[model samples]
Target: MKRINRLYIKSIFSALVISLLSCSDDFLTKEPKGVVVADLLNTPKGVDNLLIGAYSLLDGAGSSNGFPSYAYPASIRNWVWDCASDDAYKGTTLGDFATGGEVERYEALPTNQLIEQKWYVMYDGVSRANDVLKALAKAKVNMSEANVNVLSAQARFLRGFFHFRLQQMHFQIPYITEDVADPALVKNDHPVWDEVETDLQFAIDNLPESFPGEPGRATKWAAMAAKAHVHLFQKEFPAAKILLDAIIASGKFALVDNFRDNYTASTENNKESVFEIQSAVNDGTSQGFNGNPDSWTTNPYNRFLPTCCGMYQPSQDLVNAFKVDKDGLPLLGIGGPKYNDTNLKNDMGINSADNFVPDTHLLDPRLDWTVGRRGIPYLDWGINTGNEWVRDQVNGGPYIPIKQMFTKAAQKDASHTTFARATAINYRLYRYAHILLWRAECAIEENDLPKAMQLINQVRKRASDDFVMGKVNTYAFPSSVTIDVDYTKPAANYLLGEYKTFPSQAYAREALQMELRLETAMEGNRFFDLVRWEKDAEVLTKFVENDSKFRVFMKGAQYKKGVNDHWPIPQSQIDIQKGVLIQDPAF
Candidate 1:
């Protein structure tokens, strides 16, 4: 809840730009002397300037203003709900929305718009890194070999990072490392996954072990973490484990003790984060504009504005994933009877509770960390949610009347209620807990139940007040309880659900999945996690049926459609590419 915008202090682009421009008067001069081509372009300072220019892409109107970035596709598109629904991401059109829906053939026109944006942004990054790499090859700047290697490594890491995002989305994209021979030609070479792997491998091997005392700059650990993720995507489990373990053992990072710390603006640059997009709110008119997606999605006023886009919202599917307790327990069977608290309100406003279910707090720590309910004490909560009241949107649902969730304090200033205030929580891109889950996934794949259990318990150990731990006594259903829609099934029989203990492993897996569902939910991990685990079919089926916890809490009015799964690439891209680019199959 603390405002830590002050912690964002590193800005290498500015320094590089200044350094490059100061090299020679010819650098900024319009005409070359005596018609001779300027030598400044090839100079060390000029090369540095080029690198700065590459980084400048990150600050372009599309990205810096929070308009178009891979972050949108990567973090928001597929994750608004467990599986997309017309009510959510319109993912039902993707055929994976878990409900039976018509397949939406990719309309080249709309899909291309987003594709082009992501494509160009990533390539822009690659082009810049390539410039740095090329400069290092030829520049005669008098610097320590160590410094040169460090800088070069950072560049390669960035290049690899951009490529990784591109490859994941488009599956195939041109891997242009240098300025192409013809600037007019947008390179059309789409490399296979192997080639993408090769590029990332180079980054892993050559990157420096750490940044030069700066957090955002690429480091050896960042490269390794990226490599681990890439390897996982390729199903190279051993190599993935090796890379992940290397990063973990380096002792450079760990999970923050307070779960909420990872999301608070004040803790933006905390040690637990392995890597994160460095966002800083410019001073002056933009008092708190740090370029975070949270400012857009989670802020009260931003979402209400017609012009401001509503990228994502916590789906009832995800909101239901948290276990009532933390001791690695399941909630479905042991989760007990769902309870509704009419008085409950989100940090958003008074009627916010209309879309929320109170028993969600049965999950204890995870819920407290994920969403802000009525009573939690946050000084900033006072600033944002206090005494604010606003009309709630009709959420396009029939089961519940949409309610506005906020306090009188939040609604006072229309500007403060909007994203203009920077009240949204910053997402943690990488955390130590994910490492534990990663290891567990590997163990599960290997069928090493004991190892998987060990890692899971480690996470549980840290989450002291979670459901399985029995710390949350408020909603603890009696051991003899069972819930069945049939009404004929005895509550005791349902509670036992063929398990003797309250939160059994059968229930625990459900619990862990729910924990993951809630823990990483809107942050962008859900869709990918489902696909990677190949659990989409079954999980989404439940999602569409409105049987998932999120829907259950809302009394099951949401209809899941399959098309909601995959997003249609923006249409504008196809129009620009004409016949050059192809659209994704089934959109």
Candidate 2:
């Protein structure tokens, strides 16, 4: 409702490339980049771009001028804010995001720019989705029942998602429907999950399982997944179990064979993808707005993108999470809070050209796929030498995030060289593994430890089969981790084994929770998951201290319970809404 674009900023909505061309020469061709056409509101193309515009903001980048780096606070990836947990650092320069210690620590305030940016993006997405619905209502004259159902369903699904994202961040939020006369007047009075659920249910009732040619479009199963994901946050185990069971029963999704497949652009919309926010490049626009502009700052600094600013480096605590026992089971088994006590060897102050050996600790194979440790192969981008790929090893740490990056070969079409962190990579919002783990949570609650073990094992089985490997031409690890010159061997001392039994409900819960962390680590789910499980205060308080030992910038950081669970409503929005909106309690 309080749009940054309509006021200080120009256009927050993405530029829908609408072409109105005659069969004549270049004079007849008029391609409007940012403005929505008033005349084409009833035409099919206008409605289509409005729909696409709703989908576009999922990446948190927009405008016809140029690409906004995905590292910004609004990115669906949640890299900056989610770092408030233990998974990663704000990285790059210490004062980066220019937030000081706001996000990385719990020093954030109502006036933080990141908070305002993220709030507006979510609301912008809601506004765009409403636009599609209102336009469709007026234009339904030329549409069939089936077409309208699918199109309207998609808009509702997006509207549900944008509000759901808002709910995840704040304690109170307003759910704006198309019927609302003035969204600014809408009160953040009661909980919006019921409204969110209704929208998603409509999507499930009308959406198809697949869109035939459109892989990015939301399907019925994807809608179910979205609702089930919210159910987890609400701790609605029975309701969540029902939805997840129906999805698995549908047999519509499964994990991709290789763990690496989930990260690369080539394997997007694979078997595991439940719902992916689509991005593209090189479709004739001067700027690649359709690509992942959000990724610009989360990668290794400058080695790939010449102007790359990302250093969303993995934490030493997160690295220690991969520690496995002799049998390859996690060493931090069954809620040992000291899981991060022993860190794998790192190259903190070491130079790039210096000799550094890869850590020989027995680790889950997913670690290599998730993190870019010193001596490991970072996808197809060659062996990661400490400090070379990172901007400041002292502040950002010795590792970079690998899961959010692309394989070297995938970068050709996946990226455009012009300010090219805008990758064509599809952001996997929900994967099949997520449903399995969500169900595992239900199984744990029911004291069905065996069922939980079985579900958790299904995910680990996939991890053990896939290990990161250096490319044929890349440098090899120090023989301790590799056997051949082509780097045919697994990159790290990778070992992922299945659990035989859960032993008890407590152990099963801890194991299941840890599995979720190992699986989704650097993808920006850590902080919220900690909060969802009510472990944010304990984990994050200790996290800042533990993380502070290495990342000096977080030395005095703290996470206060009740207060830090949700970010404060941005002061800007509250003022704009007058008395209609109130800030979250205590901050």
Scored by lDDT, the top model is 2
lDDT of 2 by residue, 86-151 (tens): 888878886566573577778889998778777767776777777778778878888998888898
Per-residue C-alpha lDDT of model 1 across residues 369-477, encoded as one tens digit per residue: 4433232322233211211211222221111101112223433331233335333333455667777667666655566656666766666555553211111112212
Pairs of residues at least 3 apart in sequence or in different chains that clash in candidate 2: 70-293, 70-294, 297-310
* Candidate 1 lDDT for residue 193: 57
Off by more than 4 A, model 2: 1-39, 63-71, 303-307, 333-337, 470-486
Model 2, position 143: C-alpha lDDT score: 90
- What's the distance in Å from true for residue 274, model 2? 1.4
Error of 2 at 113 (Å): 0.7
Query: Lowest summed-lDDT stretch of 10 residues in model 2?
Result: 21-30
